[model samples]
Target chain A: MSFIQTLKQSVGLSTDGLTKRKTVTFGDTTAVGNGRFWSIISVITLSMAWYLGSALELVNPIFWPAPSAVWDQFINISQDGYRNFTLWEHVWASLYRILVGFALGCLIGIPLGFAMGLSEIIRGWFDPIVEFFRPIPPLAFIPLVIIWSGIGERSKILLLFFAALWIMVIAARAGVGSVKLSKIHAAYSLGATKRQILMHVILPNSLPEIFTGMRVAMGICWGTVVAAELVAAESGIGFMIMAASKFLATDIVILGVIVVGVIGYAIDILMRKLEDKLIPWKGKA
Target chain B: MSDLVVNDVSMVFDTPSGEQVHALENVSFSLKQGELLSILGPSGCGKSTLLNIIAGFLAPTDGTVELASTEIHGPGSDRGMVFQQGALFEWLSVAENIGFGLTMKGTPKDEIKKTVDHLLETVGLHDFGEKAIYELSGGMQQRVALARCLANDPDVILMDEPLGALDALTREKMQGLVLKLWKETGKTIILITHSVEEALFLGERLFVMAPRPGRIKKEYSLPFAEAGVTKDPRDVKADPDFGAKREEILNMIWEMEEEIMGQAEE
Candidate 1:
């Protein structure tokens, strides 16, 4: 069985114990109640299939290392350092770069977006530049960043900051643009000054969009950081995976991939939890 | 006493096609302090346009609106507006939305809370004070809208199809609430609606407007609104005079719609 299936079963997750047969009814397909159970089952099933397929030597071991071997590699990396740096050190390096880059992007981009959204002159001035850079992937700038700042943390962080900047700017602008005219008029009629309206109505209304942008930017930053590290970095999950792949260390590569995926997934989950707590009225209105 | 006077207000819009369309023409009317006026017409009627002009959201090409002898240049604390829907702040609780006006005017915190609490009770939404606006039903949201407007205690309250989104039963209940609020608060109100029954029931002075180059076609001083305050709205709607006026205005608007359709076909 695939390591994931074994992991699932080990964690006390199995649908086979439920006595009632789940009849897949039409129209209830989108219903969320039993869907979560099915999702877990699907993951468990995939892991089992991978495990069986590998044990039977159905696929080349070079491409798909056996789950147990990958697990062993994970345990090996946990004890012995990968390339002079521990797994946590690599994870911390990647996370530090992402945090600093994402923070810089949010700090500068949101206010710029607000300004562009609020003023026609500012929008006109910046729209061309934002639109020009937005579609250009963050990875495309790695070479330029490396050339300018050298293949160091600055280059990697700068690339990630640029990757997050345009997304946040567009998001903040959209958030400001999303304020309904009736709401503004309502505020004005209630004797709110222009500043008060902007602070209370416009700012609060834009928050949901800002949160959505942040989630998207975080995901993009995660992907961009890995790609950037693969291109140059000497100490990161991406670098470790890249380094392992050169030596045909399939198990180490698989383990590194899993670690990166897990960290990215964890970050997203944390963001969603924070979003739910902070903006409880999101989409409810 | 605050009297809202619209002196020959006209609105002309220059369409992108380069044609200057007269949305309103010389739509003049006066509302005495504590009066309730309902402007009713067909779809293209500038009844909403007139209301917007009076609310200072839109400027008229000609004429001016004066409230309590002061000309309205823009939206101010003297006027409060209730939109049909989507006007209440979704991010805020029902109490916060209601108290928005007072908070904006920088009223003391305790005073805002006091006014919001009283209005919450007034609109029968006392228990929903802490509830987010989206949690409420359409009728309840409108109740919040009404309470929010009333919280400001403006000289003139403007409503644009405030109960148009509610179901028939809820609408009838809200109609009674409107009459009750009007009678109790004694604030001049201008309500715009296409519903003939709503116009007949809620208006102390009802104006039936014509569509093309919209102007007041007819005026009716009705007893239903004053009676609706003390009696069941069903009883008010059951009045012969109310029925006659409803039919008359419906026919007037129906013909206007037909005339517009004919023009479109031509």
Candidate 2:
């Protein structure tokens, strides 16, 4: 088959006859063409390839440690500790910083965004400042943060906070701005006070967008937290990785990288689940 | 005494390029208590502008709208509006939507529930109260919109092409519901529509309007709406007078459109 045909078939879009079947019936919970099954298969295949390549010495162990070596390093770190802090300590420290920074961002950013969305004067006042700083990388603030706050937890948390705030503000504003004029008119005609409209109509309608912005902010916060820790931190996953790299402990570095990725992925999944619960009517309308 | 009076209402909108668009000009009318007034016109006739002005969503450049001898200022629960589309909050259930106005007014929870339940029944949506707005069909959604508007027990209901989006069968059914609601509640209603049949069938007092400085061209006091209370809408439409009035209005609108096109060409 041609590449385009095969691609279409893979997506279940090629067959005209199948397209006519509106009702979908699954044979079992573990369907062959299910997305979860494909994901598992892909992960297994990649792991096998990594194991084989390392076992055959296709890559130098010094540069790219074997999966087993990385696994051993992970176990060792939990028991023996890395740089006087255990694996749990490093993970907890990073989690604390991220949580604090993200919480602060949401607290201020959400209201600011709503204000900008609601009033032209507020939007005009903040638009320039938000736009000017939004495009700059969070890492770019490292030097100034270090100079101002020193290499303390405050600087690290502040960096993550900045990363999350801009994303949240923009999200909230966009969400508020997008509410249909007709809906507002309906509210007004129904004799809603300005306060009532703000609470009942604008807030609920803007929630989906706010939730989306939160998810994006979370991803950015996670990335920024690690970079912040790498720049200057006594204990964190980023610190562990940085420490390991300096000593040429490739296995520990790999383990730290995997841990960071797994934690970030887990946080994203949690956020998505919360979004589904909070905004159940998001796409339905 | 009139329930609502609109006197010398005019709206002029200035575009960004310094051009003025006259949306409505010298539009004057008075609606009696419990009367159904339908404003019919071609697309740009500013019928919607007039409705918005009455609803207090917009301020007319000139003139006053008085309800019960008091001048209108801003939107209040006294005047309820049903938009062309349902304009319902998608996140809210049918019952919640109906109760929104009551809730805003700080009505007791039990009273809100009772009123909303009654409204749901009146609109024939008793079973669908718990259903989300999006779950219902277009016709059902409009029914909920009507129920929501009526829940407030406003002195006047302003509907801007409330059934414009419905299919032909549903539109006819909704028109009947409007007539029923008018008879039952005795609330004054001003419905704006582009449909000549809908205007004649639902309106006892009909205003035919022309665009290009949107103004009322003619007014008719028709008996079809009264006849429709007892007779089938189709039967009412079949009357010779209904045909003659429809043809006359259709020609008037056609001439207005032609004049607009000729001006555009220039």
Cα lDDT of model 1 by residue, A143-198, tens digit:
99999999899998899899989999999999999999999999999999999998
Q: What C-alpha lDDT, on a 0 to 100 scale, does residue A87 get in candidate 2?
A: 90
Instruction: Give per-residue lDDT, candidate 1, residue A50.
Output: 91
| Cα deviation of B210, candidate 1, in Å | 1.0
**Docking level of model 1:** medium
Model 1 residue runs over 4 Å out of place are A1-41, A52-63
Q: Give the winner by lDDT.
A: 1
lDDT of 1: 0.90
Q: What tens-digit string does per-residue lDDT give for candidate 1 at B1-266?
A: 79999999999989999987888998888889999999898877788889889999899999999998989899997899999989889888999999999988889999999999999999999899999888899999999999999999999999999998899999989998998899889999899987899998889899998887888999999998888888877888898878887787888888899999999999
lDDT of 2 by residue, A14-62 (tens): 5455434635546533323335545667889999999999999999998
* Candidate 1 Cα deviation (angstroms), residue A129: 1.3
* Candidate 2 displacement at residue B44 in angstroms: 2.4
* Candidate 2: segments with Cα more than 4 A from true spot: A1-17, A20-38
